[model samples]
Target chain A: MKILIVGGGKVIYFLCRTFVSKGYIVTVINRDHDECVRLSRRLKVTVVHGDGSDPQILEEAGAFTANAILAITPNDEDNLVICQLADLQFHIPRTLALVNDPDNEEVFRQLGIKTALSTTYILSSLIEQRASFDEITNLIPVGEGKVNVMELLLNENSPVVGQTLRDIAMPENSLVAVILRDDETIVPRGATVLQSADRLIVMTLPENYSQVLKKLTGESE
Target chain B: MSSDLRYFVIIVGCGRLGSYIANKLSHSGHSVVVIDSRESAFNALSSEYSGFRLEGDATEFDVLKQAKTDQADVLIATTHEDNVNVMVAQVAKKLFHVPRVMARVFDLKREKVYHHLGIETVSPTLIAGDVFLESITTSPIAKREGIGL
Candidate 1:
């Protein structure tokens, strides 16, 4: 895969070495001239020295033919703009952005950037994951995870105990498939009200798992 | 705030443009609150300015909420970096639902994305470039007729 990376930081440096060793075509762009010289020498890859957010700079970096653009700049807006330009202007297939502030991730996604990840959010979610463990359990992955089915056990503390399936704001591309209550399996309908001790069989797109988990358990992450 | 009352303006970044706007608006009797990551940037504000000064990264939700961006009638993001300005402006406009949000974008090329995203952007580069272009185009007319900047 051809990869274009934007940033002068350690993350970009490490990724450059890793991707190159794996035999992927790698290119980098950094605003710092000194860092560009160092990266060009260390990685034996093309390094363009300019503001990554600028579309002209992206064009100069050969963004058009890149399979993916990973914008890991420390500045969230620059990362967002680079990804956006790569996606919208160049029609690059995949775009990833490093979010400095986690709150901007949703907005970035809403603005049509494919993947936005943040070290701040990941590390914080790691902590949150430990605190909110067992809220959702993976049952099994069917068909190489195009469909993910999970079992969500509802307790009295669950946010959906009294609410019907229709009333609950489930994440997009997710639904309650079945409700295992005692000896009977109840196929969930919109009017089906959640009861405590109900084992919900949910089928969701894999990416929406975390949101579904958090909402089902009433755990604020 | 009530529409009949003076506007509550929140200006992020106390850099040259931010300080100027803060000073002008505060003098005009609007409630002005300026935020910058560096406290020293606040020094640029004129002594006549009597607005609130906060030192924090305005792009952060908590920092902006602390500055009461939700209550802002007008939120102007004038950070030196276009990236900062765009992020802060979006947070103010989209997240906090501020009535009017403006961003100072240094790169003129970024105006399209800003416009598409529905955030009002003032590009200093375009403003200055227009003046330079106008001078080049109109200098001959001005020299003959006598009045042009």
Candidate 2:
């Protein structure tokens, strides 16, 4: 997939490296002339040096053919303009913006920028997750925060450890997608039995997430 | 115009142009609220300007909400930064559904973007360029040559 990233520091560099290693076509638009030169020399991605919010710069960065565009500028206004331009002018399918102020996330969403990720929100959520829920190895909001993907670790003391998938009373609208035990990935079925040390990848709606977690890991709300 | 017909306006950025517009609007009996990040910017407003002065960044939605932008009949974004003005204008127009939205953009290329987004723009650069071009084309060179033609 072709991806375009605008205006970031070390985070952008690491992201570009990772995407390049994965063989995805990556393009970066940066305002810093020296950084652009360094990125071009160090990575396989194309780097364009100019104001990312500018339509001319976006066009030069191949935004028209990009499948996804990430506006990671420090300025929230710049990020908003970049995402809006990508969506309205280039018709990019996915437009993501980095909202510096947590409150602007909703405003960005209202303006039709598909995804607005607030760095502060994400960092605070991570801290909350670590402090509150340990069994939840991973949690991610998908489909515009309508659905959640959770990873729960099952241990010997878990209530559903030895139960079969069909026998366990899973919450409504929740599905155990996969189980990873001893490095074996299993697509869960009705006959599949849960075992100790099994890592479950579950998907559920936001309303049913806590119930699903309680059922899988015996964690109470 | 009657008092009932007066518009409730929100002006972002207390720069020279913004202050001037706010002063004029307030003088005409329009309810105006001017927002600026710096408190000292309000000093630019004249004594005739009897509008509310909000000291906060206009890009933040909370500040806009505090200024009651949702109830504004007209919103003007006159920040020095074009992107800030564009963002504020878009939010005011698209999110709040303000009846009249305008911004001051300096770049000629960004004017097209403002047009596409259905926001009105006043560009000093473009206006000055047009005036200069007109002055050169309409110059009276024969008078300087003593021809009096």
Candidate 3:
């Protein structure tokens, strides 16, 4: 994908790296000359030194031809304007914006902008995870609750240890998506056996949350 | 305009500044709508804002339609990404014909270009710098803008 990113901060830097690693054509626009120099020298991406919110600058950076535009600047207004330009003017197929304030998400939505509110999402995830540790570490709803993404931690005394996924009676709506052991991640299969100290990422229904948690952690209480 | 009349405002990208604007606008009797792709971002909003909430990608045309962007009088894009904000604003102005479009700009060099394109830009870093400079000055000329510390 041809991607245009407007920002030179850590977020843009990391995103550029990820996109490049995935073999996407990435171009970054920023006002900071030093940052632009650093990215150009270090990363396999294009760097443009200009204001990303400006039409002239964006044009200079080839915003009109980009397949996807990511507005990850520090200011919410800039991100919104960029999305507008990409969608309304250039008719870019995909435009993603980073929302700094979770409250204003509705405003962006109403204006036909796709936003990712990181602060609000991260804080909510942390709070929810802390509040419902025993049930599930992370319960992220996907596709309007048709599927849920959950993170489950396994303990040494869990009853499901040493048993394969097929041996355990998994919830009807639940399926293990990924497993984190030490630092590596593994895709769980029916033949995959449960082990102690494993962190499982599962997809299930809201109603099956408790059941899935119980089956994975071996703690009914 | 009657003080009792409610104004509808759409703010894209619910980040720090976006949330601040939403709180201020809603408190001032404006009906606010927020849209973000990240479902978890809605927690920052207080229950006082009873406006519609949609969790989806802002870049997708369907998501914008779901947010009712066509009916909004003013659209504010405060996302960190400049490209996204510009794209959203451009669409609102050219296609949807939103009366007012305000964008937050982090890059100072693009300010002139944004103005030329008929989009309002706000930079926190420049504003903060002006505020800092105004505080140290003895003449108090900077106080005229009310940007003092």
**Which candidate achieves the best TM-score against the true structure?**
2
Q: Chain B, candidate 3: TM?
A: 0.84
Each model's lDDT: 0.83, 0.89, 0.76
Instruction: Give me the overall lDDT of model 3.
Output: 0.76
lDDT per residue as tens, model 1, A1-221: 89999987887788989999999999899999999999888886899999888888888889889999999987777887788778878889999998888777776766677788867765664454445566454355554335667777888998889998999988888888899999889998999999999999988775886788778888765
Q: Model 2 segments beyond 4 Å from truth?
A: B1-4, B139-149
lDDT for B24 in candidate 3 is 74
Best prediction by DockQ: 2
Worst 10 residues of 3 chain A by lDDT: A126-135
Given the true complex, what DockQ would model 1 score? 0.28
- TM-score per prediction, in order, is 0.69, 0.91, 0.54
User: Native contacts retained by model 2, as a fraction?
Assistant: 0.80
* Segments in model 3 whose C-alpha atoms lie over 4 Å from true places: A130-141, A144-147, A162-172, A178-199, A206-211, A219-221, B1-149
lDDT by residue for model 2 (B24-60), tens: 8999899999999999999999998899999999998
- Tens-place lDDT per residue, model 2, A1-221, is 99999985899999999998999999999999999999999889999999988889999999889999999989999998898788888899999899998989888888777789987877775566546678778877777567878788888889998889999988889999999999799999999999999999999897887788778778776
Across A1-221, the per-residue lDDT of candidate 3 in tens digits comes to 89999876787878888999999999999989999999999899989998776777878878778999988877676777777767766778898888676644555766677655556655675565447466356667655235678787788778888999889998797788898989888897889888888888888886777687677776653
Higher-ranked by TM-score: 1 or 3: 1
